[model samples]
Target: MADAQRRIAELLARCDLEEAQHRLGELVFDAARQAMPRNLPELAQLAGLRKVPEMFPGATPTARIQAAIDTLSLAGGGTLVLDGRILEVTDTIQLRAGVTIDGGWGGFRAAPGFRGESVVAMRRRRIDYDAAGYARATNLLNLVIDCNRQSGVGGLCHGNAQKDRVDGLRIRNCLADGWVVDGGYELFGQNFEVIAASRRDGGVAPAPGRRGLVVAASDCHFADGVLQHFPIGLHAPGAHNHFARLHAWSTYYAADPPLLIGFLDEGEGNTFMACSADSPRLADNAAPPGRENGGYGFRSGGNAINQRLIACTVQLSQYGDAASLPPPRTIIPVHCGQVRATILGLEVRDYGSAGFGPFVTTPSPAVMRETTILGGNVHEGLPTNLQLPWSEPGRFLPRLCIAGSDAGIVQARQFGAVTRIGGLAVFELSLCLGGLRAGRGAVTIQGLPDAAAAPDEGHRIGFQPVLSHWKGGEPVVAVLHGGGRELHLLRQSTGAPVTGADLTETTAISVAGQYFTDMPGDA
Candidate 1:
């Protein structure tokens, strides 16, 4: 670049004024040739890229695209501009560094993309790594990558799972699938829809754990994408990710069970806002042979530590607990996570008319930061204790759910009602949502009621039992009002994991979907 600049100056000085102007124009053209391409097509030709169709016009589009990409990679890097036609390929095409496969040649969907076997792969195929530098900042913009083959195999785009083989890759405005962000760190993308992966048999029966996206790397952000029809929508197992306005639709496979919108294992400091998940079509989805159709909207644990789901909507279709399949299915089946998770302002609705799945199953050895379900409506009921939570009088007030089956009833023209907790009768309140396990004992109001006739019970009884240690702070104790009827919804507006209960009335919180919402599992 410096030599070219110097020569242009000397050439102009030696020419006459008219000749100088003409020659200077020529010099500018020569310099521009050495500069980088201003657009995608020019970039594709950087390394002597060729449109295989033009050279062999009757050849299959698959061969043309393969030859073009391979030739471009050999020539170094560039965008081999593809026409607006669907090409086909059999094997995974290596996406090279400084290469931009701009299917949208000019505007959006310009080239549309290839429909073939596998997808663009950033795998670590460049052996002697130290000798051959890895791919960097690869961009896939404005294209449709269709990897759905009739053969029922392949991924759309696969990243290196073992090492940081890619950095700063940006994928935007593309409709594609089989995304594995495992090996790439710092992938910034938005406005992309990942269609369901290659199904085992045209989706008649599900493939094991088919995924729309697996984000194992940290510091990744995705937005405005509809991830649908996979066993899991977003499989994130790292930290510091912000997901905004993502939709997970019909997550579970018909025969396969355990469908979830997203699963984060060992993931920390993540924020999920304005996300919605549902398994609407699973009403008659019987599991394959020995499998059961069960899953959650979202699940995190296994050192998943601190995360927040704010103002999200998790609407589960009607599902039932099957016979113990190796591990027993949780009764109040959704929203179960270990450790400190703070769920707030989420709309949870169960649309099952036959059998009822609980909004949140019992907390195992794990409890959310406070399990605050503030400012949301559960069409059926809030988190119910279908299984009684372990309790010690005056120490812990367990958050309970009303079983769907027990919601409406009539007995002697009287709807059962009570607002008190004393002796063994108080311990019996946890059983109301499932079956009335009425107890025999002398009952008294354990906590003072909101009364107009009596003096204020500023000394009203309440429990502040320690639930679990906060992810980045102290052990948090859930503050119960009355006899734990309402959860004091927590406000977690920042990236830090610290949460505080401020509001008074909240209903449902997320505990656990694609096929169903999922719990966090190992990568």
Candidate 2:
């Protein structure tokens, strides 16, 4: 303990305090690393604390550990290492900046029992504005969270520090609610409720800042973890954040409500890459929207300015009703401003009953590109404002629905220039044409093998042909709209299937399909 205190004091005495703190962080991290032994029982041990489950009779070791952490925080900044027995944190453990909790070899074991609550709860409620905004001053560093908790960690992360990283964390089992920040909530009790001020109107006003992690975070990465609680996995509302190599297995909601590592607000930018989410199994009685409302894979508010979804997989485990389904809004982007989102190299399937937002309002400009919309039944049932006029004048290209999407197209009213690239086995079924306001609308198609030779079947009026793609080891079928659609199948490589639908031009039309070139052909 005296050695740790002397280290903190020496680091504080540096000329460049912040830089010194970072250097100190490296040193402390190295110490923690050296302290961890590949061989058990050789780890460091501190005095004055008893083994968790074997403490001084009635005294709770978790409480004692927490008290020690609180005291160290009040003392400014230090490290706490937990070893030996299991420490079950029944209540919230508030962590001040510059404090690192390293749970040794056995890791920190926390589970929810009796109270039926989630294990390892943090951030009891959102901090008030007058208080700290979860911001960091390089005070908190090396928060190594490695555990074997049967139930995962509950509560939004208040890690609003710049250049902070949470890595090599392993969470398994017991996932009711993953993590919620800004406007995200955990399903600790019955219903998942939003504690933000935006949700409470006619009721008792929520005490000033009584929410979750709503701080402005930057350069944070939540990587190499697994959260299996379906629906809302991890919600982040900060800027310059990255979510990589995480797996979410949700059993309650199908692909209707998607799971996410975290969500960003309008002023923030984030990227989600190389992630996977699986829906609930088909046989269970977990009735869809039996009574619940507003279920989505990912739900972003009106302020998410720029975000990207790259190389992700969202698959449904069951087949449910498409018509009598509980109006599940697939991806809800309400009144979003200037944002550039690219969803690429996606593999989606089993979800046949889903829908996208109708560009539903007048907005300035927004762009979505290189997205592969597969196996989702995008029901364009009604004409709603895509909400584009509210944005400034610019070109918006949501080049999406590359493959395996059904009825995957829409239009916004009084919108700017829009372009779409309908890839292999895609059908663009439209209702009231004005909804897809392509000021100078255009379509580009590619990668179809059937249309290159036979110009006859390319002109077929009512033939729904099945295109095959590999899934696991078996071949899966994808249906595309043929006949009546104005897509001129250029070569055998870009032919549409057969369709019973009609294609009209409410704005203006320029048809380009499947490597379709205008000159001497061979496109």
Candidate 3:
């Protein structure tokens, strides 16, 4: 066993990333098969998997499970079978490498005796990396985790100097609730399911930043999951992750603005493939409005850059019972700010109140510069301002916003889609679109007139422009405006706008976008 384990380690050290994940997945499954009671006739079966049985004196499932894990780790790693006996977790047991928690979903019960804070966690550690057959291998083959308590699995990465880096982790067939995960590198989550999520002790509304999953690790993958009943379905605060065939439904309400997939805080270079996030709130339990009131289907917050959503659909509505009515006047299915978003085969629909704002909206043309939208449908389900003249643009906002900026310029290309932008007087246009800072920066047609009509037309317009770039200043007012086009200078607060006699059209421009240099092709 020792020789074989060492050989596997050597193989891992040599194989490239994809090959390593494939090899380790097979190895862990093989180990699990070998450890099942069917192979060891001495052990009894529970819930169709080998049962480790309760330990003496301390018969709690947590204690027995820990003891079994310790035993398995000391003698190399193997599978730990669970019967789902409603274990109440007071402390989290860190999983070791090469250990697979097999088949817990079949018998796991919730709402009766489940009292765990967070069922388990596996941090990136040297022991995991160096252990001959420890958990750096694929762990948790079939776990049904219920954080009846308040905590997320894979809590913030544990590393020196707080560098969040993780590698060599795999969790599959996990059906969990509460806050699900904070992700890790080289991590693969397959066949995962979450029916609901919250920090609610019993009822809802007390959930604190609750979500089904939060991916904060790069090079990680999550595929084939149905997540529902959470404020935010998946929040990616880290970069370079991939998600496929993920469905989030039955949205809950939150003033923080619920989103199906949200990439925020400078998280860049992520991909969503064949992903769909929508509210079944219209269908679930007769559509009493089921919580997730008006909000964005997918939104990119400040600094979120270079993301691709391919073959993705985001359908949201603010429809709910009177108790669930949203306060906002409109809802946006997709909003992108300061992002080089590449959207292909995208579908966005808004069916309820909180009138549909935009299929994809960005406040600054410079923010979504280099954006490309190809082959998609943006439907508001009614005669919307999308049809009205730009004059009545206040009735409904643009389907796409490419308002330019200060630090740089804006660039966007639409292969096939209905997008609108109006009121082009913007010198450096930026709009604080909504209630939350996370969802602000809406460019309005009513704006830009201030810049176009400014008295000084030589220098950049402090008034809003189609260009919305930032130069490390608050209320960033610098304009990337230079063309034979006249420049408008000064703000309403500072002097008057002036026209330059020798202003030359800009032949060269610097860009601010960080990601999506190469657009994502297909799922």
Best by lDDT: 3
**Per-residue alpha-carbon lDDT of model 2 for 1-523, expressed as tens digits?**
3454355445445443444334332333231222221111111222111221122334454555555554344433345555533455555455554445554422334434423233333332232111455432212222222222323344324432333223333332222333333222121111121211111122221121122223334555556555543333445555666667655543332222222212223335666677665542222123421112323333344545565556665444434334223233333322233345444444343344343233222233333221212221122332222323323422322221213231344332222232223322222221222223222222322223223223333343232222212112221122223322223211233433222122332332222223221123221
**Model 2 lDDT vs. the true structure?**
0.34
Encode model 1's per-residue lDDT on 413-474: one tens digit a residue: 00112223221112112212211222222111122112211121122223322222223223
CA RMSD per model (angstroms): 15.1, 16.2, 16.3
Q: Which scores higher on lDDT, 1 or 2?
A: 1
Ranking by TM-score: 3, 1, 2
TM-score, per-candidate, Cα-based = 0.54, 0.44, 0.55
Q: In candidate 3, what residue range of length 10 has the lowest lDDT sum?
A: 508-517
Task: Mark the regions of model 3 whose C-alpha exceeds 4 Å error after superposition.
Answer: 1-56, 83-90, 107-117, 131-135, 149-183, 197-202, 205-208, 251-266, 280-294, 317-319, 323-329, 352-354, 378-523
Candidate 1, which segments miss by more than 4 Å at Cα? 1-67, 70-77, 105-117, 124-135, 150-152, 160-177, 197-205, 251-266, 280-293, 317-334, 352-356, 362-374, 380-523
Runs of candidate 2 with Cα error greater than 4 angstroms are 1-59, 71-78, 105-165, 170-177, 180-216, 252-267, 280-299, 319-338, 351-523
Clash totals in order: 40, 49, 52
lDDT of 1 at 146: 53
Question: Candidate 3 at residue 232, lDDT?
Answer: 64
